[model samples]
Target chain A: MIDYQLLDALAAIVSEKGFEKAAKKLFITQSAVSRRIHQLESMIGEPVLIRKQPPKPTAIGKRLLNHLQQVRQLEVALSIRSLADENLQDSPLTVKLAANADSLATWLPEALMLPKAEKVCDFRFEIIAEDQSIALKRMKAGEVMVCICSNEEPINGGLVSALGAFRYKVIASPNFVKRHNITSVEQLTELPCLVYDEHDKLQHQLLNELNKSVPKYTHICPSSEGFKQAMIAGLGYGLLPTLQLGDAIEQGELIDLVPGYFIDVPLYWHYWQTESPQLKSLRNFAIKVASNKLETLA
Target chain B: MIDYQLLDALAAIVSEKGFEKAAKKLFITQSAVSRRIHQLESMIGEPVLIRKQPPKPTAIGKRLLNHLQQVRQLEVALSIRSLADENLQDSPLTVKLAANADSLATWLPEALMLPKAEKVCDFRFEIIAEDQSIALKRMKAGEVMVCICSNEEPINGGLVSALGAFRYKVIASPNFVKRHNITSVEQLTELPCLVYDEHDKLQHQLLNELNKSVPKYTHICPSSEGFKQAMIAGLGYGLLPTLQLGDAIEQGELIDLVPGYFIDVPLYWHYWQTESPQLKSLRNFAIKVASNKLETLA
Candidate 1:
């Protein structure tokens, strides 16, 4: 039982970063913003903001902000549904989501292009490209309304839907294979390999399957595009997503190190289990698109 | 006083995520990897890694990994210096660094291009497009050896160098400006604005300076390139870095709302305080290049 007005004030203060600015954003007086925050703190029985130069929300405050944002989103969705004008020009629905870089560069745009999503909603998409673990954390923290992550488990009462497998192949530029005379896993050990990040386990998984050791030297490129560019530049060989590799493979810019050996990373769509029509539409669209775009494990 | 061998085994385990895989990576038996970890733990009197599926490092373990990585970089740098063949085909020094997205999209490439860096080091860059706060946290956690961040303060004995100011101008597409009939800061509130993330303060700061309130709605695109693309697509107005906006502005894609009202975010380069030659070269190059590229306040 929270006051939407007070919550609005809180969100504005956090986003605008101070009482003075928050007051202006809400079109209220500075004193009003202060009083509202004081009321919130009194109700919560704890300080919400650190009250620094650029004010930062405390852990509890951050959680409340997340809560407020979620509530606001639900309200927006409800309003969208209640509107009689089906042809309303501006849908007023903003969806904040997080996804991995590979998805952002590939199937995500297609998934978002579902007719229902495009026609009904004036979709304002705020997409954050992050690692699966970080994306999951953001979703749990309520920083994002939805997250495309590898984790199958749902948290904070979120709904989880399978998005099929993202298959990866150990790939290198044609020049690298010929220059290193790499025909086997043992040869790969002597050459530098490219990794997405320290948290990336795909290369190790491939080597494990091959019964080969990790190379002493490795190149790390945290961005999906950078990883691909590095491989194309002959910096190192790496496990690249099939979605991203198709163009390069067709162009003959890259060659599969071992054609038959591949790893399939299963992806899941996680979203808050809400009755909002917008969320339902998004969920259905995502599932349908992912199934079509992602590789099937048959 | 720490055994590099045990640390290497520990790093391998954390990166590879299993004792068996770590053993294979280290070219040792699984029993030996286990024995080394056990010996290291007994010496330290604490567990270093969480023995879970896809293992994670403990707080102390993460710090040790950072330390080991730093030590390895120094060893490589020293070896490069000692090599008799100055024209050695490939220098083995790999530098792992973190930088903000704006920097990565702008002046960082030129900084990395200094002749000494290219010739003497085989750069393995992990470009993390993170905010200054997160970038600072990662640097403090020893996740990166050097970071180009906005934080002026030094942490964990890291050296800090001023890398001039990154000037930002509030801009919008010509079409957006004409559609909204935006002529002043007061008009901005009626339209949607673009934000880098929830933590983005530049828009608020601009509004505060103009004595205006923040808009009720904003479009958040966390990636630098995406932010620019959104603006180009006439999504919203935003405070874009001058470096990123140069070509767009020249091509008549964007127009500055207020000619003189700009925010100059002072950039800083922070790195571990080490006498490593590789770090020295990188720091020097960054300072020189940043001074030439970034704007300076008189």
Candidate 2:
């Protein structure tokens, strides 16, 4: 097994470009840094450094540096969560999560509510527009702990857990629908439509389902919050996450245009396939929250 | 103009969960942090924080936090590069580049070398899978300064510079080709093929071009290094970049089959649309290197 502490020392040394400076920056002795590097190289049976004027990293060293950088970020986040947990005496792990704008504006908030709340882990959410592959990359990079990904294929070296299917319905604010007298999605192309930027295929997918062309005149609102606000303010019609419509539906602010049709998006939870206690706790909490929210809404 | 520093402070405070603690972590005074937060809230014209118990970020603050995180990373990278340049006294603006595996194994190294040393900056490369959309996202997220993207459509917030085109030819080690007695591509359908993981479209694109069915016995090589090694080791014959094969062909390591027919991929340079002097220097270096390489090779 790889000693993570050695990897961390190596990454710091490589980033600083010398053991002396890395030691000074890390508040450690230069010999300690040197020893750590030596031990790591001996363990790996490969020379990781080219001890030139500035001590360049060998190819293997660079690869290890990249991996170490990712690991270091994860460590930092874990440390912060630990600190937070100690301070609060309840919150333990911080699960940094990223999802699409519509999903964040829709069902994600409700999914943050933990049922058991055993270890007192706090959940942090971020809305990003990356595709599934990119989402997996972020997860691996340790920028985010959990990713709500569209990919059915499991990311290499990551745990795969199903989050059930999320369906999207073509929706419009009641005022906008009433003012435009909109009924079916066939007239979608003619009406001004709000979209989640260029990469968002929700509108295109809906148009394709209706066997109609994608509208040429469309306004780009990249955030789900902004998209929902725009639609409510009568900017345009859009396909919204069914969960996003719940409060609006109850308040009589928004309504589905085409009742029978919806796009079902299967979601999965992908995390780094590690045996850390905090990661497992986060995974369980997310699964529980996802199940409860999905069962209640779907 | 948005003050990036304010956003970073806000994100740190939100992540830290309290004013005093966030200040201590950032090595700043609590009053300073409080003032910054007030300024941010005033500028955004929204209450960004909930002051009850451990502070929580408002929904808009959370959105800002995500954007600020990306911006903070870019700012950190830029600062690190700037500091490295100041200390190293030479090659301060080393460009961190990202590309697909095939390009890295093939034309990218050639393009990295400028005819004149003065025309080049220090270079660092991160090779990834051929999914250019992911590369673009990485570039946008500040993981890389430059990227080779396939999509002609401009990355929403980045500038695009054309780098001519790279053509991929179906090739194999001469020994393997001779051993298999392969001539026509139709025969290739019967032979084993190599692919770059499931997401790779190279072999599929070749088959589509030939109007032939995909070979069932496909060897998967996930990395560019692995793919090249597999071809050299005679694991299977597959498409190789024309640039990558040049030295191999001359050295009698590889042979092109039906050389006239090849896939032409128009490559483009995508970078952040910033006017920073460091970015400008790196951009100019890339353009010079790319143009010189293309002129010499094409």
Candidate 3:
């Protein structure tokens, strides 16, 4: 039988990023923390951790962490169900989710509010903002319990459901289009543009649909709020959600470089097929609320 | 003498994240990319990359990356000066900066505007949000060219200057304080609180000043915008910047739990002591803008 103490030590190390800090959190000595990991490695007959300055988990270690997370989530739900009545738990349930920043800035906030209003679960969120194109990695890497992302393909143990879409437009200031004289779609490749980060593919995907090569010059801004701010400041033309850009588009403060063209990037919720009671409620409310708030995919 | 080709290959590998992608970017075969890395490793007599899935830089690799980045920055500045008469460059300069999310949401945006207003240099930013408590690691690891952080200490080759402070207060919904009957600071340790992440130290610092133990329950939210939304939604009490919470506090939508008590987290601009012409201008303007906008320390 695998000892949870050994698993807990691994989880703490990953969380704290060092044996000393992990020891403090676990209320054990640093050597004790090392011994637990050694014991775990002996039982598994494989190295779970790569010993370095601030150790990192191996592929097997990530799987073990995933297992521990799922088990702990189940334990929390079971305790809430059996020991306490209603949505009361000994502590607030932390639902770690990976999501695209655009969704977080717009529809997801409203979706977050729904669970609280409907009394689905008394939980707190730990949101990790990843570019939509690569958010699936967070779930597959065992970093998060669920993911609200652009990718529809679910991981092996997870289920996927449609969660509507964010309607995005390639936007620029009037000065930008005027300065570059970008009247035609084919001319876009020569001008500068904005990308959320290296992983952001919205600009490329939209460009491909328009039959243009990627813009040679790009500004990479990782913050969603800052991304829009940079676009408005005429840093470069790039795709942003119309939900947040409504007034700017309507008032001509920000012009849609592509007049009528917009990308309906569909969002999907990827979560464990087998879920705890609290998590099941979160999944239900997130989908229900997102469907009501976001642009529906045809 | 180190070959620029080998350094460029190493930089591309780090930027593109893998040999295959780096090969595509550099217009070279995968074997060529491997050969360059092998040559770089041989010259250094130490491994540059960890050779894992998505190869991470070794300690020496990071220092080499930092050197390459600084050299590239100088090259861009020289070209901008000689080849281009104006702020015009072959490509816009990209300044990768590490900053806290709260700063990004607050005064940093205003500071960002000043450079563009003055035409310091035609540059774009790549921002990485690391919590204020641990942001120095970004500079030490060569992940960012510059950093706006709370840490005042200068690194080996970098300098730090005061950028004023973000005044923070312990806050909650009026209903929350009443519901918990939390009139005294001692009772706060028992109630649930909100934290940005494990790396965030503001709450603990405030708690220490208040002579209280760490809160028994906590909610971790990483996004600065969403963090406030959660706090306002009565998810949990947390320390937030008064700049964003001024109207909320005055209107009683959010209450300052510890009346007349605030923490001024001093901000600093950390950058290389020797800077390129474009970067020197940026340093001048960022400090100028931030000093005017943020809370002045007594």
Candidate 4:
């Protein structure tokens, strides 16, 4: 077990970069900081900090540093929570969330605005990819209070509620269409198409819809932000989430081909079946936000 | 920032549920752990441990503990990496993989049995749906070396090779079939069906093939393993992944309904354009395994 003082010393030293600077930051003597680092190295049986003019952490030290930083952030969140508990009549409510990259990049950002909603509680967002079920397991372990996933089944007693369906469209840059003389998804084989990631389903889904195979030419554009950029760059014709494509389409950067043929993915928000006030507030707020953006299943 | 020592102390205390027990675990005096807790609270200006008889952590404390655990796991992984680097004459290789839950629960565990898979290098597996475009983004991020998705698009700088088309059958236990007396996918709405998750297109795909909407009474089965279990438990009818259903069907635990109709999600392994040794090894091995099990697309 590490001593609190020692971990504090490590954080201070890493942030300060040198014994002298760390000493000033921690209000300790430079020699004391050096001694503490020595003590930590002895205990861990590994050299954590590299001794240099501007000291840098070894891989071990870097890992330790990151760990400490996360701990500190948690502590900070806790303090705020405590203050809310004392000052407010109601306890601080946290809305734990899980979402995918595209959702995180697009509509999920609206979750940050939930705190400002009429709800009188704190909201904590844990944005994750839709692809990560392990995170869902964490939610099952009570790590998160709520999750927005394609997974409709409740994990470990979570209440499953339908949010809505998000529609996606096969899109390409106007320049791409003109350059390749393409009009249909079949022409995708002859042209490059932007994709969110290697595991992205747009191209595959496109082919499946056409009762054809996936095209031969594809470009990996992993980031949602970058996906738009890649489309504009004419890297390839890619599937664009309707929400993201709206602005680009307005700007004449991309064109929605065979517009009515869109993919609608049904989404659901699963929440821990708990009776906490904070969680209730979040659940209601999420429903309200999603109701506006997502198409309710008729 | 949280003092690392405080986190360590909290973990010890949480595990033991008492100061004395925690001290014993840490080989420190009870007073030492108590003092550290107190010091941590003061530093963070918040109370993390409830100081109850058993000394349970507050929600904030729990959050900090979770973050610390994640960091610690990363640290251990990094440590193992360093040790491997020092011992191996061959350069360390990292392989990134994207897969789905069905594969994860069934075929994937056996697929990763490469000799010295863990010892010589690091393998990061990113779990996603069998959708191809999702895998493409990971490939673009340089995060995954290969993906098992339903896309056969030749990535601009990558190669697209067929793994196989996995066939899924609409299945139900004999008990369930007898109870429901179901005949066609149209009667699916009348009988409860198990959906893998909200984003699972299986149910929707089934409904779309019939040009109908998803039924109202469909039960959400989020996990692949759990979904199988639920189907076996006669919770509902569902489309079962072929690999998982084979043995169970043979054993009469499950029975196929509407047998001739199946969803064939063709899988492909797309690798990066680079010739990195780590990637080459993974690509060849994956191809070898896939070829044995899957039909090639030529």
Query: Of the candidates shown, which would achieve the greatest DockQ relative to the real structure?
Result: 3
Task: Using lDDT as the measure, name the better of candidate 2 and candidate 3.
Answer: 3
Model 3 Cα RMSD, 1 decimal? 3.2
Please give the lDDT score at residue B297 for candidate 3. 65
Candidate 2, residue A73: CA error in Å?
12
TM-score ranking, best first: 3, 1, 2, 4
2 or 4, greater by TM-score: 2
Candidate 3 runs further than 4 Å off: A28-32, A84-89, A113-121, A174-188, A246-253, A256-259, B84-90, B113-121, B174-187, B246-253, B256-259
Q: What ranking of all candidate models by lDDT puts the best one first?
A: 3, 1, 2, 4
User: How much is A33 displaced in model 3, in angstroms?
Assistant: 3.7
Put the candidates in DockQ order, highest first: 3, 1, 4, 2
Q: DockQ of candidates 1 onward, in order?
A: 0.19, 0.01, 0.42, 0.01
| Candidate 2 chain A: 10-residue stretch with minimal lDDT | A120-129
Q: How many Å off is the CA of A173 in candidate 1?
A: 13
TM-score top scorer: 3
Tens digits of per-residue lDDT for model 3 on A1-298?
6799999999889878999999999999999999999999999999999887678788899888877877777787677668656547545677888888787666675466443355644666778878787888888867888898888888878889998988988888876777778878887776667787778888888777886577677777676766676666666788888877858877777898777888898999988766787777777888887877788877
How displaced is residue B60 in candidate 3, in Å? Answer: 2.4
For every model in order, the TM-score on chain A comes to 0.88, 0.67, 0.94, 0.65
Q: Among these predicted structures, which one has the highest lDDT?
A: 3
Q: Candidate 3 has which clashing residue pairs, if any?
A: none
